[model samples]
Target: HMSFVAHSGTSAVGTKVDVHRSPTACNIPVVARRNHQSCSIVPALRYCIRNERSPKAPSARPAQDVTTSLAENLRALGADPQVILDHPDLRAADAELLTSSLSALSDWVPRRSLGALLERHPPLLTAPLGAWADFLASFGFQRLAIQELFLNSPDVITSSSVYRAGQVFLFLRQLGLRNEEIVGPIFRWRALLVEEADYQSAASFLASEGGVPDELLPRVASTYPGLLAAPVEGELRPRLQFLKGLGPEASRLLRGFLWEDWCGWIHGLANWSTAVAPKLVALEDLLPGGRPAAEALLREVPEALKCPPESRLVPNLRLLTGRMGIQGESLFVLLCGAPAILSLPPEQLESRWVFLLEAANGSKADLLAYPPYLLASLSKVTGPRFFYITLRGLTSRFMNRAFNGGDAVASESGRRGREVGAGFGIAGSNEYNLDLRWLCEGSDDEWLKRMALEQRAGPGGGGWSAAPLALVVGMAGEARTASHGQEGAKELAGQQQPQWQEAGLVKEELLLLRGDYDEVLSEWDSLLGWCCDKAFTERGCKRFEEQLSLFYLLIQGRM
Candidate 1:
């Protein structure tokens, strides 16, 4: 019979029994009855049976045996037992046995030290913390695992401090971490500071490191203005203050380096007279206001011009004149051949007059060859055109010497004497013929004739020279007025035609005049187009064209 009992608590206990029937038959084995009682009695029976241990289930093999079995199994699979064990998940006891078995298998068993592992595989130090942290935890080395992870895995540590601490807990203290290695991740963490508008963090980084990244200088310069404006007294302030102390030269150098968008920074300083005023004062002191400074400045100009190499002569001229005192006569003299200055009438003071002359009886070659400076000086005293005529005479003398191998001055004197005699109406009244022969002496007759015909046609067939003729006649009248009064000059001009007819040189003079007029008109048109295109597009009309038109009109009126 089996008995069962029940227990409530320490102080209360109860017992009960109940019997179960067993089936029996003839020739059948007798069955024992089960006695039901309190549940406490059933547990006691169970404990007794358990202690009885029917077969003493085979004693568990030693942990070493299990490890050995695993090692052998791994070896049969052609894997190193120690490697299988070290793979993080294996039991500690199994790992030990596997390690031992590997040592036995070969004399070159790899040491399982963390230092050796890290040295062999530096990338392991840079692995994520969670991966290695779980690994150490499996090995029952949680605290040491955290430490090892932090010290070895700087990339992971820098990414998260909590992860780093967890790593430290696993790895137990970093074995041989270098300061640079530790700071490397932290430094990168603070790189964001460089981009910050305050720049304090970036400046601090630079100050600590002796030099910042070369790429950051431009950013600093660009952000410096705003940063300087900020009231923060930090690393950025000192660095910026140092930069400001460098003055203009440093600013210019910085601009040269960071070529991108530097012009805006410069333009901002256009109103910054506080900074610029001192420099201007210094410049004034250096240059002063006299010819000495002007001369020195001019001396330096050639070199400056050479340095840039692309600057034009016109702007250089302007700057040169601006730097020196603008004495009207000198400026005009320097600008003699430059017709561009003529358009600047407002700039042309009364002291700066330019005269055009008709070298009526003088040589054209002599006029062109005379030194420009001499012509300029002469223009100051004599009428401009008269000076030109005198220059023409001098040029004629030179050409006469060069081409004729004789004195042109003496030749001019003889011509003048002939003209005087012809003018009196005593030399057959053939002044026109005489004048034509003298002017056409060296030139091609055919070309001269063609020019005369074109001039008679007038420029573009537009009579524009009428006004100039009136002006010229009036001037001539004025000149003769002192001798014969307006009436006599009027008569001289008016009688030109009758005189030509009486001298029987009308056709010849007209032909010669036509050719000369055509040549002059064509040349004037060409010169007008060139000057207008090159130098005076801003002017409303072409000066030479206007002058040519006027000249043609005057010739037509005379005809």
Candidate 2:
């Protein structure tokens, strides 16, 4: 017994049919009915056809050989012939040509899965096999490459326009994609070959309108294959204009990053336009520099485009100006320095600011100078270092009236404190901005060395050899060991000279001189070619001495 679904529309009465058949007999028995009736036949016609079968008196009989020869040829080719025979949609496939094409491919292509491949992409069997084979071979594609191409994108076989494929392939290669690089994009976006002009126009628009250079075209195409089909006037042009409307900084940054290729750029733009933009425009009144300053802030931190204005950016701005006591041009300076602060959660930014103010003896100016301090992890670098500094008596706490009350009160206190000359010089001065700068800026070895030097001098500026140098060294070693186990501690400890070892001021002096040297070089370079016209009297002498000092430092290292 065999069971088959028979849905036929041939019946004038309009009906459905359930057809059951026996293997041996051809029994054609019709049970007739009125309008919209359904019935099943015995073994004669196992399958029903739209035009031939009477579905109102729907009956089943023996199934016919719709693709007997097609099945036989497929089975002979070592492929699943049953798939083609079983499918109702593929019932009319030309058996002779399909079989001939399969037989012809026996030499170069593997025979095993050809029928299954055709079943998946029936158009390939009907498409001119010779054209596809010739097209692949023309492009230096080997048998393996051809097989891979077909397996990766079966529809490419039906896209018989070799000229179209060649055009896109050449265009991609021109855009810096090699033969291997072209394969993945080609397979993923087969329409590149099928609709060549559309893709070419899109690529051209990216170069002409979107400002994507020739070099980045291949990357852009691969990252945003859908862009090839995106409408120029509607989607691409509007998005380009919207991004350009943000400002030169935003436009330039977006062009550099190719935001069109990024999936989230649209959503980010939406957020910026509706939420962030209004907040920034509104900031012209609230903050110092107004909308222009806000634009500059967005340029510094493009990620700010994705954040909500009221909930995220506005709150962080308030915290900086209100809680941190940063106002006017200082607020602008801080924003320009660390625009990422706008994205930080209120609690996290507040905690960091609190720690900075309390532990590091840092002021608003210090935070402005080093914006990255706001982004540093508390537990990893800030918290651990703060605890260590405080424990070693390197830092002293003073009730900052400005922070306790407001900026006005803090200003009054600072005026009185400066008048008294209360905390002056290296050891006595509680303002550890220089120390904090070095601590945060220097590497791990440098950090350990800097801490040891500060601790060695004690509370007085001239107290050299006051504190136990061995104790400082031990503390650094303990911190290193605690942070990075025995191996790291041993490596670091080995770098330091023994407590009894003779002091060396040469290296320290040289480092200070080098830092100054960099500043001078920066000033000179800032002039560009204009420096040539300047008088070379003292300039030559100053540079000569600078070189001489650097050479002396090199010699000391060798010694």
Top model by lDDT, which number?
A: 2
- Per-residue lDDT for 282 in model 2? 49
Alpha-carbon TM-score of each model against the true structure: 0.17, 0.35
Per residue, candidate 2 scores C-alpha lDDT tens digits across 1-559 of: 2233433445334334433321121222222221123222111122232211222342232224425666777777666777655556446765555655665555445676665676676556654455455545444445676676676676665653443454555566566665555543234446575653377677788778766777777777766566765667765666656556655566445543434443324323323346455656745655555555565556556666656677777777777777778776556545554567777766567767765664355676556545567776554455444444444454421112111122332243343323322231101112224233333544433444545455454543244432322222223444556688776777866775444233432345435534543453343344211222121122332544453343234223221
lDDT of 1 by residue, 132-232 (tens): 33322322333533554444443443343322232222111122222222221122222221223343433344334323344443344233323322333
Candidate 2 stretches with Cα past 4 Å from truth are 1-66, 72-80, 85-89, 104-108, 112-116, 135-145, 159-191, 210-374, 377-381, 388-559
lDDT of each: 0.32, 0.50
lDDT of 2 at 273: 47
Number of clashes in model 2? Answer: 11
